[model samples]
Target: MNGFLQEKPIKNFLQSMDEFFSNPFPNSAFPLTVKETTTANLIIAELPGINREQIQINVYDHHLTISVNYQELITEENTQQNFFRSSQTYKRNSRTVALPYPIDEKKVKASYQNGLLTVTVPKQKGKKIMIEES
Candidate 1:
């Protein structure tokens, strides 16, 4: 009786983990590189087999978020045996970065080429505010 109770929880845990890993985005994190320059910060991410339309980027409260989702469909047929099979695969990932210093979000730029994503964030210039003597 005790063994049955313990086995149920173990099976449930394994099933949950399988469901979590089925979607690669939240389970696996991709690799990236960041470089800082005098005027701007550059970020490079490696994303192979992904199209520009499958990716999304957003900046809010000094944080930059990059997300991507791609799907591929495959179908196979056997004429002699009269067999047909169809399968689908999906790849996804998301990454968020925190800027070291304040950035000019309006001036930020990004580009994707050769399976690499590059983002340039320009630093915000300090504006001097004049104080009047009372």
Candidate 2:
């Protein structure tokens, strides 16, 4: 019984690692939150050190996609008259979210401020269906 339990846990751990490595954008993943308002659905994404010009937002087939490409610069100075300069260039990341309710593609709007990306998708009004004789 003890051996069986240990084997199961190890198997589960290996499976989890495999799943993690299977993702293409493992390091690019960030935090996000979804919320629903009375009139629209809202998605807030936290993206620090990313410029607005480097971000793109798109809506297609009830899906919202956010893509970002940025460059990170690292500089180090040493007291022994040595300097190190390194930069990570053109790193790209994207995330897609499915909208719960239908939205007007033309009315979709997004704003970024203070490292927060806010996307508002206005809900589409559905026509009422009238039932006659069955």
Which candidate number has the best lDDT? 1
Tens digit of per-residue lDDT, candidate 2, span 1-134: 65764697787987788898887556766778889888888989999878899899887878888888767777666868776666666677888899765656789889999999999888777789999998
Q: Which stretches of candidate 1 lie over 4 Å from their true place?
A: 1-27, 101-105, 126-134
TM-score of each: 0.62, 0.64
At residue 44, what lDDT does model 1 achieve? 88
Model 1, backbone clash pairs (residues 3+ apart or across chains), number: 0
- Which regions of candidate 2 fall more than 4 Å away from where they truly are? 1-26, 72-88
lDDT of 1: 0.84
Each prediction's whole-model lDDT (CA): 0.84, 0.82
